[model samples]
Target: MSVLEIKDLHVSVETDQGTKQILRGVDLIINEGEIHAIMGPNGSGKSTLAYTIAGHPKYHVDSGSILLDGAEVLTMTVDERARAGLFLAMQYPVEIPGVTVTNFLRTAKTAIDGEAPAIRTWIKDVRESMVKLRMDKSFAERNVNEGFSGGEKKRNEILQLELLKPKFAVLDETDSGLDVDALKIVSEGVNRAKENTGLGLLLITHYTRILRYIKPDFVHVFVDGRIAEQGGPELADRLEDEGYDRFLTETPVG
Candidate 1:
């Protein structure tokens, strides 16, 4: 069983205001096949934790370790992390103007597997995943996220997830800007990835709508740059009903 452990992680970023600390002493563990939802208010550091784990150069790791099945993730480069079975789906997927979707997916698959996929089977897999996500056939030829609708970009992220088959995926607010149907389709893609590959998930979101479909095995309430509370699916239901009002009391934003 693969285990992704975050031990007292502290992260910071250099802002125009100068150095700013984001994640403060965050800790969690995600075993393969577990879906862990991280819910928090705006500016509560949900995205910080996701980007930190992915080793984004912008986010500085002040201290602590990110371990994946006994390997030190903090020591790995961004691509090394991906090759090691770590994936991050950004909130705003950037447009790669010169890169077609098919080319991008194939390149990523090859990079992660350390060898190119067989052409015939790889094309078939991409098409199947796109069909499952309700993407148009022409989407395979379009530049990645270039002029795509919000829902389309989000669906494409899931398409990559399904194709890449990472051991753990960190989705940063995938539900944002998606309509109900789009949200359901994206969630289905995520569930399919989990069922097919036992993909552990670190889903970061402000709202609980996605949880209704993805059904997190554990729900963590993030407040003041840390996990203030944790529970099962029931915790998400409570957050949906009550909102983050209770947790807002302790946030001393300067």
Candidate 2:
């Protein structure tokens, strides 16, 4: 089975004031087909972990390793990491002004697969995935995320997720800005991707609402740049009832 491992990962970023540390000694292993939920308060290093795994240049890895199937992911470039079957669905997806959704998706697919996909097959796959995500056919001709609503942008992210079929995906606050209907649709799309590809997931969120739709096999509570507690799905239920007050009161461990 494919596995993604994070070992003693310590990360920092440069701010105007000085270098600010984010993730500290975060160690977790996600085997294929497992859904891991990361819940934490603001500034708890949840997004930092996501961006760090995706090799965002701003986040510096001071020490430790992120390994994918035993390969060092920290050593790979951003595109190289994507080609290696690592995917990150950003909390705020950026707009690609000049690139049509069609061209962008095809180009990304070609890069990841090392060859252009057969035209008819590629078109059909894109259409089907888009339909599943409730995206309109006209969206194919529009520039990526340009003039799109928040829900549209998120659907576009899951569109890439389904079509790209990565080994693992880090969805950083995907439910943000989504309404009840949009949330359900996006969650279903995510579930379909997991079922189709058996991709492992690192789902990060502040609220547990998304967890109701996309159940996690493991729930990890992030506090002070590291995991404060971890448990099964029951933990998420408990979190919903009782806030992060319990975790926040405890002193952080190095």
Candidate 3:
């Protein structure tokens, strides 16, 4: 089943220079239980695409449609999109000074699930997920993303993914800024989440390093704010070997 669909989507941002178009008539469809990786160079609108799908308020869809599970999502509010089973893991997680991780997780759970899990059950689940992510139990009491290392933030996002178990997740460069050990641990957490919940994934990344750990069923090359090319897992290997030079040359600019 097609869980998410982007048809002739155009997105833009307002700036001093006026409207700057980011995504230009981009089209994509992600089915349930599929892993799709979108690879691109910097400023190719990879993150923009993810944020747009998740209904970020800053991004405006200039034209076209985004549908989640057959419903028009472009008209929905950000929280409404989340409640509709979409999740976005940002490239950079923001830190909230006063919100502890446990409190934040429970609040998000309450919002999404319409009721928070019992305190005891929630704590137990959080601890188990933390241990699976190779994190210490003390992390539960720490502020969300505050004073956390790059790897810690990434693992925390995966931890939320596990706890919430969204039907579809858009992971925007989750493997960036991590050491080998952290990468392995984050990859393990992601794999475990997918295995446990069969979550569909749209992974946005530039390097193929993470692909080695979390295999993708389909690979797409985003260039000039649109999907310039797409293929199976072999496409990622080709990009790894040949680089994105051809895509840059072939991609059409609107």
Give the clash count for each candidate.
0, 0, 0
Against the reference, the lDDT scores of all candidates come to: 0.93, 0.95, 0.91
Model 2, TM vs. native: 0.98
The deviation in Å at residue 49 for candidate 1 is 0.5
- Put down candidate 2 lDDT per residue, 1-254, tens digits, no spaces: 99999999999999999999988899999999999999988999999999999999999999999999999999999999999999999999999999999999999999999999999999999999999888999999999999999999999999999999999999999999999999999999999999999999999999999999999999999998999999999999898999899889997653
Give the per-residue lDDT digits (tens) of candidate 3, residues 1-254. Answer: 64788899999998899999999889888888889999989999999999999988889898999888889998899999888889989899999999999999999999999987998998889999999899898899999999999999999999999999888999999999999999988888888878887888999999999999999999989999998988999999999999988877784642
Off by over 4 Å in 2: none
Kindly report which residue stretches of model 1 are placed more than 4 angstroms away from their true locations once superposed: 250-254
Candidate 1 lDDT over 1-254, as tens digits, reads: 99999998889999999999998898899999999999989998999899898988999999999999999999999999999999999999999999999999999999999899999999999989999999999999999999999999999999999999999999999999999999999999999999999999999998888988999999999987899889899999999999988888865332
lDDT of 2 at 178: 100
lDDT of 2: 0.95
Q: Indicate the TM-score of model 3.
A: 0.96
Using all chains and alpha carbons, the TM-scores for the candidates as numbered come to 0.97, 0.98, 0.96
**Which residue pairs in model 3 clash with each other?**
none
